[model samples]
Target: MILFLGTKSGKEETKLLAGISCPYCKQTNTLSAITSPTYFHLFWISLFKVSTNHFVECSHCKRAYYKNEFTPEMRQALGID
Candidate 1:
């Protein structure tokens, strides 16, 4: 996954833009890494052009997100700004 660091509300941390999180578990408090050629290729294809995609993970819930689900602070992290 493509990783970036950004500051949110005056706090800095790392996050994934196209990472996957387990949806079944929401409070496991564990985070996992995911990477695949198709996923990476899609992200690059969209990023290289004028498209923006955001992927988020919930360590506590293992849930993932895309697009509108991303926070404004995360936009800066993934170079969306």
Candidate 2:
């Protein structure tokens, strides 16, 4: 008998937080929030979610920032407490 099991990680864009100037690119309306989920898989099929993480990105510069790194305004924009 043989068994196949492993973990898979993926990222998805959750929603558009707001139109704001990016600190890195200094561009407006380019920052957005993304959700990254890590999960367990069996036979290439997703079984259960292991963990999830949130991030902010600048569409202009393609820079990514973790949720905890978000500023007060940014957090509020995303409706995150």
Candidate 3:
């Protein structure tokens, strides 16, 4: 028998914070908060979360930006201090 264990990474849209103008698409009310999780998996099942990251994505263009890249207003809307 063989055991399979490894790490897996995935992104999830956590919430629809206040919509804002998107820099890439030049659109309004398109940015949202997304959460990315890297985790340890066993037999295709996520066992434990190893780390987490936050991002801002443009719904219109599907562009993603790291938390640090988010503007002050965006971070404030997301309740990130």
The prediction achieving the highest lDDT against the true structure is 3
Residue lDDT tens for model 3, 1-81: 999999999667577755578777888877878777899999989988998889888888899889778888788887889
Please say which candidate is ahead in TM-score: 2 or 3.
2
Q: Which runs in model 1 stand beyond 4 Å of their true positions? A: 1-53
The prediction achieving the highest TM-score against the true structure is: 2
In model 2, pairs of residues that clash are none
Pairwise lDDT winner, candidates 1 and 3: 3
Single out the weakest 10-residue window by summed lDDT for candidate 1: 32-41
Candidate 2 displacement at residue 48 in angstroms: 1.1
In the order shown, the candidates' Cα RMSDs to the true structure are: 13.3, 2.3, 2.8
The estimated TM-scores of all candidates read 0.35, 0.71, 0.66
Task: Please count the clashing residue pairs in each candidate, in the order shown.
Answer: 2, 0, 0
Candidate 1: tens digits of C-alpha lDDT, residues 1-81: 775533222213444434333445633324432222122224223222222234556666657656466556445545655
Output the worst ten-in-a-row residue range by lDDT, candidate 3: 10-19
Relative to the true structure, how large is the alpha-carbon lDDT of every model? 0.43, 0.81, 0.82
Off by over 4 Å in 2: 24-26
Off by over 4 Å in 3: 23-27, 60-63
